[model samples]
Target: MNTKLMGSALIISGTALGAGMLAIPMVLAQFGLLYGTLLMVLIWFGTTYSALLLLEATIKSGGGLGLNSIARKTLGKGGQLLTNGLLYALLICLLMAYILGAADLLVQAASALGLELTFMHSQIIFTLTTGVIVACGTGVIDKLNRLLFFVMLASLLMTLAVLLPEFSTDNLSQVSNSDHIGLIKTSAVLFTSFGFMVVIPSLVSYNSEASDKQLRNMVIVGSIIPLVCYLCWLFAVVGNLPAGQLKEFASVSELMAGFEHDAPWVGGFLSVFTGLALLTSFFGVAMSLFHQNSDTFNQNRVVTYVLTFVLPLVGAILAADQFLSVLAYAGIILVFLAVFVPLAMVYKLRLANALPERYTAEGGNVMMVFALLFGGFLLASQVI
Candidate 1:
């Protein structure tokens, strides 16, 4: 009911749904339904805990410092440099990944409507769309993002409803191809799925007036929505496709291509859904980058808009054909900053003081450290 609560919900949901939703079925099909579903729960909670730990650290450092500031305070100059470099890289790569995805989706949507366009044309259109939105400013971006979020949610639910009746329980039992190694690698998808946790500190600092209890409840409830959506989505997608088909497609677009051949209208609708989802996601990350860099760049709105949009557009153009690969790269970088960095910040904060007596996790710093290490291990395993 609180406006801040609503904002937090949007932030969490917006972050959670991003391009990750589109990849769930493909990822799960490799690992099967049960193992994949269980892994999703584990990763979701781990990401949620990591987010809370980051928030606790943010609160301790007077609540206004972004990831860079916290890193500097807790981890010193080296930490600050590492954090800034990683965050900048992650944000840029993430922006490029989503932009390329959006371009691809636009190309798909146009083809569905009998409008043929080349990938380069689609890239130009997407770049322009993003640039216009960024130029309009953050308030406009936020409002559009919320509306697009609902569109994505409705589309996901609608597709699930149609696919539910066709779900096969037997299909859910298909085993992962890579066995243990494959499962761990697939978990990379789940881990980076929650990479938006970086935005929590910004959300908390912006809504500084929110009570500790309210913030905690907001994070829990906000996170649950996406986790549930992912589970439902996984069930529908993995249930609908055969194990053999899933392995052939490295990304969701490839999977949806099959759906397009069988169910043209549903696939067309999904193309639109995928496009909007990626657009809103790009908007969120771009806005965050804009805000993060605004203070450093003379507070000039035009300059901020240009740097945020143009630089990423160039990166996206360079990565036009490698959308999924770019996403994989971004995921690895995000794992380091989103998981390990936050965990370290929480530990440092705890040792410095007593967490302000109102913002301590259960079991104090011990549990927090273990959680971080566990998440770190999961993330590291993916790279090795």
Candidate 2:
């Protein structure tokens, strides 16, 4: 792969594989391995297609434009407002999830090392540490994220190796909750895991000289990397812990606590893995949010930095235990930016013949409607 393409692809993968992956086993434990794996692949496909749609629109409008600009060009000011509103909500919710998750892991890691810290203290420490890195800008984030991504990959593999010895095929079949509604709710949260679409426009500008095929391949390759890792993670975790047992934990931190008692070694490796996962995710999402806020508000760098991290930091502090809930809500907002906005932009662009010679996303109206209906069902499933 071209170095630029590979870097961009890594960005997508890093963004997609966050603390969100930490919740997969917890959610999948209720549905069993077979059904959960299917759901993972289904959401992966939907999210990848939506990303292509966004890429098509971005390339057509020229690279480097933010979501607000793309929506404005293709769907007007109302569209811009809708995109901006949803993007803000989705990004902040994700940042809050990462902050809360990373803080919990930080506390755990500290306790293991004979040090102690309150959850609130860990939250502030983790946020400020990672926030400074994000504030350094995208160029720095790209390099650091790539290096951290590799460390995260190593820890994940090591964690899986430690846990796989205890894996049982019988546990994979253990479904304590088979209710479709519960599965739907879990699916809504799982959908957010593949939300690399938010960063596509930035990637386009970052690799402006790349060919269209290179960009498309980058999205597919980047996203598929996480799907493979997630499936392996699900198999390792769920195959070892029965759904009935996993269901009892109130939060992912509690689940991590369970790991510490059952296997201190696995907990050590997992703490490293989960922490880096959240850290890299913070870099990816925070970079985008930082840029998006700056572009939308036309603020100075200090103001944009404050706009990007302050709200999410406050949210993480106040609702430190709402990690899973924040993810579910982010998933709900993701349906709009990841599905509806991309399809809408592409449809309008085609209607205006604005992208006549540009590379179009393969699917036509049928695919668009399928995406809409599918996304709508996921949204409705949340409330009903």
Candidate 3:
């Protein structure tokens, strides 16, 4: 892969492997290994397809523009409003997840070092630290992302290596054939883990010089990393914990506690992995939020600061539990904006006879129709 393409791939993979990864074992453990793994792969395929569609829309647009700009150019005012609104909501929900996730891990880390801190205090501190880093702008975030991504990868490998010895196929057969409600909820939670859309538009601008082929390869490869990672993570986690205990796992920490029971080293390593995952995601999401305010809208820095970081921080603190719930909600909403809207942009472009000669999306209307049905089915599953 080209260095630029590799970097782009890492960004997408990093964002996808956020708190949602940590939260995965909690939600999916109930659906058991078989059903949960299948649902995750399905969602991954859909998310990857949607991300490529978004990429196609971005390429058709000139360059250096975000999703809102592309939607406006392609879909008119209503499209712009819908795309931007959903993007803002999606980003805020994501930031909220990171804030709570970071705070939880920070508190655990501090206690391990014998320096106790409350969740609220750790959250406030994390907010301040993130605010400072995000203020430095996208260039800094991109550079920092590359370095932290390696650490995140290392931490993940360490966790997996430590737990692999404990893995048992005994847990893989636990399946729920009659519990559709539980299965649906599990799918909703897993949906949030595939959070690659928020950064897709940014990737186009980040690698403006790269060809369509390079970008598509990067997106596909990037999405694949998370799928593989999630598969490993779910296999290890579900295999290690009993079905009875997993059904009662109130949070990810509880799930980790179960893992740590057998492997003492897992506790500290998981904290590091989870924290790094949260930060990697935080940087990408914060940059996208900030850039939208500053570069896209020409808003004041302070205004952007509040909207991008502070507001979500407040929201996360006020209703941390609800923030997790909104991850599922936002994942559902993202189907329309991230999946359908991009497909809409393409169809609109085609119908209007406005497709630039340099189009890159494959399958044309056939692919669009297929993706639309896929997204609709995914959305319907969550709703029903």
lDDT by residue (tens digit), candidate 3, 1-384 = 777778878888888888787778767776667677778888888778878887877777664536777878888898889888888888888888888778877887788789989988988999878888878765667677788888877888999899888888877777534486767755556767887777877778878788888888989998898898888877878887776677666555666788889998888778777788888888877777887766567777777787677778887898665545767876777777777888888777767666567655777777788899877776787767
lDDT of 3 at 168: 81
The reply for model 2, stretches above 4 Å from the true place, is: none
Candidate 1 backbone collisions, by pair: none
lDDT of 1 by residue, 257-300 (tens): 86766555567567656776677667667666776666335467
Residues forming the 10-long window of minimal summed lDDT in candidate 2: 61-70
The most accurate candidate by TM-score is: 2
Task: Note the residue pairs that clash in candidate 3.
Answer: none
Give the number of the best model, judged by lDDT.
Answer: 2
By lDDT, is 1 or 3 better? 3
What is the lDDT, from 0 to 100, of the residue 66 in candidate 2?
A: 65
- What is the TM-score of each predicted model, taking all chains together? 0.91, 0.96, 0.94
Assess each prediction's global lDDT (C-alpha) against the native.
0.72, 0.83, 0.78
When 1 and 2 are scored with TM-score, the better candidate is: 2
